[model samples]
Target: MEKPAELQAANYDLVARDTKSVGAYVKSGAPYVWVTAAAISVAFIITVALLLLTAARGLPHFWPADLVQATYKEPGKEQQHLLAEIRSSEEVTTARLLNAGLPVDEKQPLYDRLLLKIANRDLGGVDFRYVLSDWLVERSQPKDATVLERMEWGNFHGFVVALKEGDKVVASGEEAWKGYQERQDRVNDLRGKVRDIEKGKIGAVNYDLERLRLQQRRLELDGKTPERNAADFAAIEAKRKSENEKYEVLRTELDQLNAEMGRDALVMKTVDGQEVTLPLSKLIQGYRPNDMGLFPKIGFFLGAIWHFVSEEPREANTEGGIFPAIFGTVMMVMIMSVIVTPFGILAALYLREYAKQGPLTQAIRIAVNNLAGVPSIVFGMFGLGFFVYFVGANIDKALYQEGLPSPTFGTPGILWASLTLALLTLPVVIVATEEGLARIPRSIREASLALGATKAETLWKVVLPMASPAMMTGLILAIARAAGEVAPLMLVGVVKLAPSLPLDGNVPFVHFERKFMHLGFHIYDVGFQSPNVEAARPLVYATAFLLVLVILLLNLSAIRIRNKLRERYKALEH
Candidate 1:
């Protein structure tokens, strides 16, 4: 064996060799590359995990869960029965349970709790309740249990008691459910007719009446009174009379439809044996969730999803469809793209090809870069003041004087919202377009000019086409940013609910001056501003996932177009 000092000397030599190897590795920058790759992988994983969590929380809500019937045996409390759907579960400390006034044993360290969706808001005055899992007994799913989705209240979970026409009971008990199923289709049809009359024919008549009133006001403003323009005045009066006649007919039809809808009523019995009468007009649908098989449940889930995306909201935006919001978001993004493309391209063209390369141009570029960093709410405020109050007000005074005080265009609207987003995204487009223009070879422009083409023609036919891909890239970024914006839209145009769409079969097909609902704003409202926090939680997740999906789809489309443009122009690079 070697001496102790010699052994220490050998160990020191090995340590020095290992340290040198580590130093060489650091100098080669391998650690930085690995760290960067690791960071990207971690970010990707986190993103996917969050999306999965959101889907887990949201998508299952539409799965038509079995209704649970249970008997509860709480300490020192009388036995009680519960009919609900299991919303969620959690583990709690015994101390926390005791603090909540539950009779939890001191010796127990933890207890399980269940969130039950009771959903009889009218009777129980609440939609959800938490119960101790240990105390629940005799749990089962009854086939006869029914769930009623309503237009006003949240939902009703009970059993079918009777079906009645006016004061006459048409069916009772099990037969009542069969009778309901028989008349369900007819009730839905009548409801559709009522909706059509109210929102279609009657709405058109009302619109015409308003237009006639505005026309009369315009004549007065132009100093063309009945004495000066007898024919015009008489024509307006005749049209008004005709519109009134149409209104009377529509009103009669609407009244008859409403009366027919009110003829039937449904009686439901609660789990605790209390009977309640619900109007058939108020009930949207009813089903026995506990009795559905896998395929039936899947079908119901699909139908529910369709209803969510297709129907207008009801019950404080907590129930029904979000079609209006979806339409508004897409419309706003498209309008913004249209408005931004021209302005952004023109500005980029001027800067890259026409403007002198001096301090002024550099200063302008710096200012644009700074604009992108500014908070979006500031842009919203500027739009409100400049676009709405200044420009829109002036337009209203100049061309829409008949609607002066009401301020037709002098309000926060879809047009102003699009303009605001265009302004917000202008810097992005300008930068991307300029970069693309810079990439076009100087030889290409010269060749086109030498081939007897004017400078303008060369730019329009050659340079712009080649740079189209970059412009699309910028547009994709803009859509991604604008579609998810809630704060700016809230101030500019978005509302909780819009009664009518911005587009219709009416003249001037696109109504730029209309306030509209947006998916981003819908998510914000449903998530934060709702009255029922528990009921709205899952919906919040669903809306967020939907907003992300919309942005992704818009980005994907732009990316596809960009790729095609790149391929088309690939030969020009050579």
Candidate 2:
């Protein structure tokens, strides 16, 4: 062996070399850089995958898949014709089948079963059924099979028997299809006219009547007696009568249109061989999905998507489009952003720019940070108590005493929902704005002051302009949180269904006091509360996808605005 000193020196040299290598690695920051990059990349991949999965499930809901007509017969059961769409399929164990009291072949360890959407809720108590794959003796997609998307009682799947005008047979076979199509076009046009008159003309007139009543009450409160305001009341009364006369004419036209649409009916035969006499006006759409070519299917798919996005929901939001939900979500987010930004920015300005730096200021900053983590539902409760019950009831008592007992603003509504969300997101905005103000170089403020600008002027012009991006960043975060927040909205304003949109032909153009549908609430309602879970499954996925899409869009809009602002103030940084 070598001398002890020489051996010790060699060990020290090796240890020093290793330490130097580690130090160099730490100085380069490669480990942290790689870790950060990996985290970001993984997050991106997960987000993209989640989005793709949502699309795969949700987008297919609109596609016109060919309905399968299968003949199912088990050992002891009679043969049956299954005329329905195969919604899904799964492999089930024989043991599980036995437990459910289903007939199972002992020879087979597993069996395939299909979840079928056998629509025609009027005829069948159940809309979905599970049939063993092995039990289906034969299956076919008949070109003559037709499906009708009705206004009520869900979808009707069958074959067209004949076209009838009153009790007279107008056409049969090929000509019947043509006649039905033509008649359907007329019915659609008539329906549109009725909707316009009912919602636009009549609704606007009703709004004015309510306003006139409020006006009369106001006149009374001001001590302007009937004699003094006789001309005003007379003018109002004249307008009201004129509008009523117009409404009566529209109602007459609507009655005539309904009669015209009711004149024709289609004799449709159900899958179980029951003949259904369906009115032309009751059917929203009738199509043969089995016979549709690729282009036609694409067209049908596009039309389905359009209807889903444009039309009002029906059947407890299990069927039809979610246009109102979409509109409410967007409008509420916009209102919330508007309400939060000014208040948040002002609070931040006062704290950072004007308030003295002390332990008290430090405590406030800490408290604001802590507020960001508070449960959203708590804010909703506060809003309901403070905004709806207290503020709104007082406003009702003061402004519209005539409308007392029937509280106008003393309820959950769009305004309350928006305000609640604003409160929930306020801390985020405040923190972000404060950080943004802090980021402005002291030299910039000094330079502005040197130029004889007031403290407020420097903040208003120089500091705030540069802080715009941060405000947007805060807004982006706020929207990301608020748009998907179902818990707070539930207590604040969202309803399972709304008869009319918050925005309509009503006065003020928007009804802030009205309850509205939200996509998040729609998802929750359809997924949990709907009587038909299997029927509502597709809608749940679709609504979830739409909610995500809406949030993404809101964030993108804010980001675009922020980028433009950043570009405008880019020179200030230099």
The parts of candidate 2 lying over 4 Å away from their true place are: 1-20, 216-237
In terms of lDDT, the poorest run of 10 residues in model 2 is 499-508
- C-alpha TM-scores of all predictions: 0.93, 0.94
TM-score, prediction 2 = 0.94
What are the clashing pairs of model 1? none
- Candidate 2 local lDDT, residue 192: 91
